[model samples]
Target: MPSFTLPRAFRAARITRTHKISAAVVASASCAATLALTAAPGNAETTAAQAPAGVKPVSANGLPLTAKDRADDGAKDRQVASSLTAGLKVTAVAKQGHTAKQAADRSADRKIIAAPKAAPNAAPKRYANNLDGWIRQSLAIMKSKGIPGSYQGLHRNIIRESGGNPNAVNNWDINAINGIPSKGLLQVIQPTFNQYRVAGTANKLTDPIANITAAANYAANRYGSIDNVNSAY
Candidate 1:
């Protein structure tokens, strides 16, 4: 093998190049180690702090989320869900209460509508079955039929004509001569009784209430009212 000595400057230059290449290789290995350390799970917080705005630090697998971070996010989600559930429950309860109140009000209204109304008038008044009873009943009927008469006036005329006898007959009177005799408590003839007979009373001329009502009706037409009659017609 032949030995040849290199120039001093070229040897120096080659040594410098070799040194530069080694330095570059060492620097690159150092940079790779630093990046590996930064991406480690323990340096997750540091990586996140150094990350750009709106960007998250990620590990080799995925986002560099710690257990506490996952726990905090889960807690926030649970809190929001719990709040929504509680709000729904409150709304449902309020709606149910309103519906119940409305139903109760409707029930009360129905009860009020269903309740019976008070009677407008009282029962019909009762009367005795005698002369005094007949006079009072006749007056009531006369008032209803618009025939005016007083109890005292009717009693006075009845006493004078038939002596208060309900079955009395006046066959001796001028009315009897014309084949229409005066009969009953008021001594009313058949023709006058038929002409002026009040409704809702007995049809017989001798009936006490019917006879009184009919005679009062006749007297009212001829003398304004039975109360004004002091003498026979």
Candidate 2:
């Protein structure tokens, strides 16, 4: 066999590099083509491209499409027409609605619990030191998770119940029947205590955040508001 020379070695190396670069380029082009094919039809627009005139279901690559992608193209015309008719600003419109809701929520919050106060001499409450912080956190949870009507009502009702005392309870049988741990701001009963399964466990009632959330969920579902419990008990 003839021995290979340096020039031949150099030629081989160049060829190998060229092959590698060619393979990479081909792979990249293939990927791009596949993505493009998976994208909207010829007339369709890419998601990165300008959004259409109205709310439109889009392919992965961002083109006007039907919700069910694999369906017949015939349905595409009518469905897309409906989508446009309903207002083509789907992404923008939905996002705008959410933004507006968040803005409104913030506006309402400013008016609601402007300066939540914690009595200096009183027992533990949600805002042991930072009343405003606690109120803000609670309000955020309410806005995001949709606080129940009862829980919402309880915001004012709680001023009368525990006066924001997370660890409040009746010294006498003023709140409950058995004198078991009617814990949290809601004065959650023993059965509810067992139901939520938070009795005397770790955090206990002093956990203002957990206590408030649990109490709010309970009040919202059970009595439709904390005021009902306040009236009954």
How much lDDT does each candidate structure score? 0.84, 0.59
The Cα error of candidate 1 at residue 205, in Å, is: 0.3
Clashing pairs in 2: 47-62, 54-88, 54-89, 55-88, 55-89, 55-90, 150-224, 150-225
Give me the overall lDDT of model 2. 0.59
Q: Write the per-residue lDDT of candidate 2 for residues 1-233, one digit (tens) a residue.
A: 89956788899999999999989976675565556546655543353243333334456676545645646554687788888877757878899999999999998888655687776889643533443455455555655676554334656655666677877776567445556646656566655544543233334555565565556656667766544555534
Candidate 2 lDDT score at position 185: 60
Q: What ranges in model 2 sit over 4 Å off?
A: 1-132, 149-152, 174-177, 194-203, 225-233
Cα displacement (angstroms), candidate 1, residue 34, comes to 58
Pairs that collide, model 1: none
TM-score of each: 0.49, 0.34
Best by TM-score: 1
